[model samples]
Target: ETLMEWQEQRQKPHVAIFPGFGSGHHIPLLQLAKQLTVYHGFSVIFFTAKWMGASPHQTPPSSSGGMIRFIELPDVQIEGDHAGMSFLVRIPLLLEKANILVEDALTSFP
Candidate 1:
């Protein structure tokens, strides 16, 4: 069968949503994913950093539907030593690494 037919036969569409680093971006995306799975009947997968996976504020996945999945990636940290540097100096590097991790996650998705 064709790809579309195969997908239809399975009766589910897989969707991956990746939010930017930090809680500001992650919370909304996660809420949206839950809504999509619980109310809209779509399979939702969330790609987030390891920190999010360990967050205590987020809701647990729905147990009955089995439509949502969480994929946690390692926290992206700066490689070099910036000993005694100010927050401003390290912030950019952290953001850059997070962006790189996001790109890598997207490219590696199947």
Candidate 2:
């Protein structure tokens, strides 16, 4: 491939997606990301918080057609008793910390 082709690939619009905290949030967003990369010729970065555990239906990066990238942010532990907490109540706390990590990751992304 020529340098121009490589440069053009790099120039594809980059999309960053944060699907909050679970499968309900992640599944639809993953579909959107796949469509954006496959049909729209854009590159997508899908971010997940590590504390949420494995996604219910995520493909490994190697099989993503080189268009979608998955970033699993370092987990941030929320203090106090989370055993009784509802997911909705805990999301805000997780996101508050995840946002900073996201920012850092984006800054270093190509």
Candidate 3:
């Protein structure tokens, strides 16, 4: 089935959190997802690139009769002389992709 059609079949109150690349962003995003699921009882989805090296130690508990989910995307490796690229040049790209992933995930929810 097509992606949009599959998304349309999902349950309600779904939220996708994207932490993007690097440990700094990933950690907090995971923590936030945990809090939302455990305390707030929200169905939270996490999106991260496979190359980011982030993984959950334990599965999030299911709520509202459905399970929490993690979606991983293929990592983008910019092959260039990073010896010259500045943080200003790379940070925005990371944020942009992260946002895109979150949007994609959200679009799947009802």
TM-score (all chains, Cα) for each model: 0.57, 0.76, 0.58
Error of 1 at 42 (Å): 2.7
lDDT of 1 by residue, 1-110 (tens): 57985576358666777675577777777777778877777777676665443341366565526666666667766676777778679767866777676677767754
- Let me know the TM-score candidate 2 reaches against the reference structure: 0.76
Clashes of 3: 0
Order of candidate numbers by lDDT, starting with the best: 2, 1, 3
Show the colliding residue pairs in model 2.
none
Which one wins by TM-score: 1 or 3?
3
Off by over 4 Å in 2: 1-6, 53-58, 61-64, 79-89
Tens digit per residue, CA lDDT, model 2, 1-110: 57986688789988898886557778788888878887788888888765766562356445346777788888788899999999889889888888888999999986
Candidate 3, residues 1-109: lDDT per residue as tens digits?
Answer: 5787456435435676766557787778777776776676667777767556665534443442343577776555455675688967866766676667567667774
Off by over 4 Å in 3: 1-12, 51-53, 57-66, 77-83
Best by TM-score: 2
